[model samples]
Target: MTQAQNPFNVVFVLFDNVTQLNFTGPAQFLCRMPGAKVHVAAASLDPVMTDVGFGIMPTVTFEDCPQSDLLCVPGGLGVAPALSDIQLIDFVGQQASDAQWITSVCTGAFILGQAGLLQGRRATTHWGFTSLLPMVGAVHEDARTVFDGNIVTAGGVTSGIDFALTIVAHLHGEDVARSLQLNFEYDPAPPFAGGTPATSPQHIVQAMQSRFYDDRAAEMEKALRG
Candidate 1:
């Protein structure tokens, strides 16, 4: 077998206004792991809205969430509000305490930072929030995926796919990861080279910042300060 048949429990924290791809990408890979049980958990088993205007039904509640070998937290606009959510924060803290692998994607790293899990650790998040990591006691690294010990963090939305494969390789094997990559047809050849700020035109970057980052940074700053 490419992967060992050991039982594995993986839990993903679901919240309102989450970026669907952040969780979905990683989940797509993790769900295929042999003997792996994946759970989408929230404070309660209710439907949660996404930033992109869709709803997802959490499969389990925090109260019944099993001890996870891997715990994933995804990020979006909702993360600002969640900073003040003691229940959510507490749950993340508790889960991270025992999870063999603590991971996050995009702004999800901020949530983990607020949970006090990123203190003095090298981590990364969506490019927009790179500078903000220091406020939460994390040293930001600009990379697609950053792994420090048992804590792994991914860059913006799409990076979750790479992050998951990294974890899969860690737990399973390199062969298993390559097989899954092929199964998912993970090849990427974007029509445009504007995904990152460095490659994008200045006007495009400014436009995106004006539309999404400005207000988000302000609200997030306020939430973290409070």
Candidate 2:
């Protein structure tokens, strides 16, 4: 195929404790994009531990990875420490310098923000941490997926799927995106209509915030401040 026929050089930046789904969900779809070449990159070739008690092996090290056409960062409990990781942050900043699309899934947006990519951009992340986007100079958008120029940010976890499809549609066309949706049986029928804060019961939302995100967000804020 000619260069125009096969052009995407997609790269996913992996780190220890990353929420596996945040990367895997989007990878599942994006790997199928026409002419797409996906690269899983990290500091080394070691298996990166994930939040779900497993490890994802990296295909390339930061120094060896090719310049990305689409660069993605996925978030997890590891993000706080990752914020302080100078080498990792530098790698992200360097790849993004020439990437056609810059993106993050869930709290990974903060990583992008740390690299100075989200400044002045309209973005979004997991609803619980949307308020922290401002710390990175990002104007938070109230949506599952927010697109500003070539930067795309997705809400928590599964929202990466939507983000990927949106990118597919943008690059190829809605018809191609629709076909991939069908191929993957992308229809979502949840047992409950309560994914987001708005749709979820107020009590559950409060309890979750109290039990988890409240503290997590506090830590994220401190990390950003540093």
lDDT of each: 0.93, 0.96
Off by over 4 Å in 2: 1-7
* lDDT per residue as tens, model 1, 51-144: 8998999999999998889999999989999999999999999999999999999999999999999999999998888889998999988899
Please tell me which predicted candidate would have the highest TM-score against the true structure: 2
Estimate the TM-score of every prediction: 0.96, 0.97
Candidate 2's residue-wise lDDT over 79-176, tens digit each?
99999999999999999999999999999999999999998999999999999999999998999999999999999999999999999999999999
Highest lDDT model number: 2
Q: Root-mean-square deviation of each candidate, in angstroms?
A: 2.4, 1.4
Q: Look at candidate 2 and give me any clashing residue pairs.
A: none
Clashes in model 1: which pairs? none
Number of backbone clashes in candidate 1: 0
